[model samples]
Target: SQQGEEDPQALSIQEGENATMNCSYKTSINNLQWYRQNSGRGLVHLILIRSNEREKHSGRLRVTLDTSKKSSSLLITASRAADTASYFCATVVNTIQGAQKLVFGQGTRLTINP
Candidate 1:
């Protein structure tokens, strides 16, 4: 499993604050995406940046990638209590089956105190 792991198994934040997470991978990959899960449940795609790109931003989300270091970072600004959720980094790669899959990490738990 050529997967990556995010640092800080858990995080705590206050409403209207910000949160950041880091991910480090093992091998080369085609693309990496970040996802968010609520209450350890369903995952929703948050952002995706490919190998050819360096940084991308959407609304309150900002993502940066460093292919040389095989790592990435995500920053969320002005978080709300509802923002409390687990964030995961997924990698897409070619397989012997000729299709790609999203492999997940343990995730970083973000808690927002109201």
Candidate 2:
């Protein structure tokens, strides 16, 4: 079962503004990852934060994970029209089979208007 659910089903922002999206999960996770998908394209890995990590950043993207609350948030600074896309949060869990499973959130659709 999917464990993550992103808040704000949709978001619209003007170019150069900041965009934030949140995700909540129900179970313990080994790590969490964020992904972006453009229209009709594959998901692009954004960043991954391990359970031991509290925050991570890459370029304009900043991610913060709060395991105590089972939630995470992604912030995009200086948003651009090209940043418009669907963002998803995925959780990695270890199964009894000794393998890791990745479950994704519903997603947040962000629209960056120029």
Candidate 3:
């Protein structure tokens, strides 16, 4: 499958702690993005890293991409209870049809306790 795999199916941490998530893909990709989904809701884009970028940071979030290793990682610092959500990694694949689509990983469920 073209979809990527995210490590640590679940995590539980106290507020103010940090959460780190990793992803690995099998095929070449144009870009990789991370999203967060609250329970019973849709996903919200968090960050996007191009194949040419090695690392990026936004607010309390950090994302790293290693195309050579077909892997990526996301780090959230000083997480709050409100940060509880399912985090996903999505790979952008260019198809022969001249279109692109996102193949998402199963995701990592994060729970932050107050």
Which predicted model would earn the best lDDT? 2
Per-residue error at 16 for model 3, in Å?
0.8
List, residue by residue over 1-114, the lDDT tens digit for candidate 2.
569999899999999999999999999888999999999999999999999999999999999999999999999999999999999999987889999888999999999999
Model 3, which residues run further than 4 Å from truth? none
Kindly give the stretch of ten consecutive residues in candidate 1 with the minimal lDDT sum: 1-10
Report the candidate with higher lDDT, 1 versus 3.
3
Give each model a TM-score. Answer: 0.93, 0.95, 0.95
Q: Rate the local accuracy (lDDT) of all candidates.
A: 0.89, 0.96, 0.94
- What lDDT score is found at residue 44 in candidate 3? 99
Give candidate 1's error at residue 102 in angstroms: 1.1
How does candidate 1 score on lDDT? 0.89
Quantify how close model 2 is to the true structure by its C-alpha RMSD in Å: 1.0
lDDT tens per residue, model 1, 12-71: 988888898999887787888999999857889999999999999999999999999999
Each candidate's number of clashing pairs is: 0, 0, 0
The count of residue-pair clashes in candidate 1 stands at 0
- Write out the backbone clash pairs for model 1: none
| Residue runs of model 2 more than 4 Å from their true location after superposition | none
Q: What's the distance in Å from true for residue 110, model 2?
A: 0.4
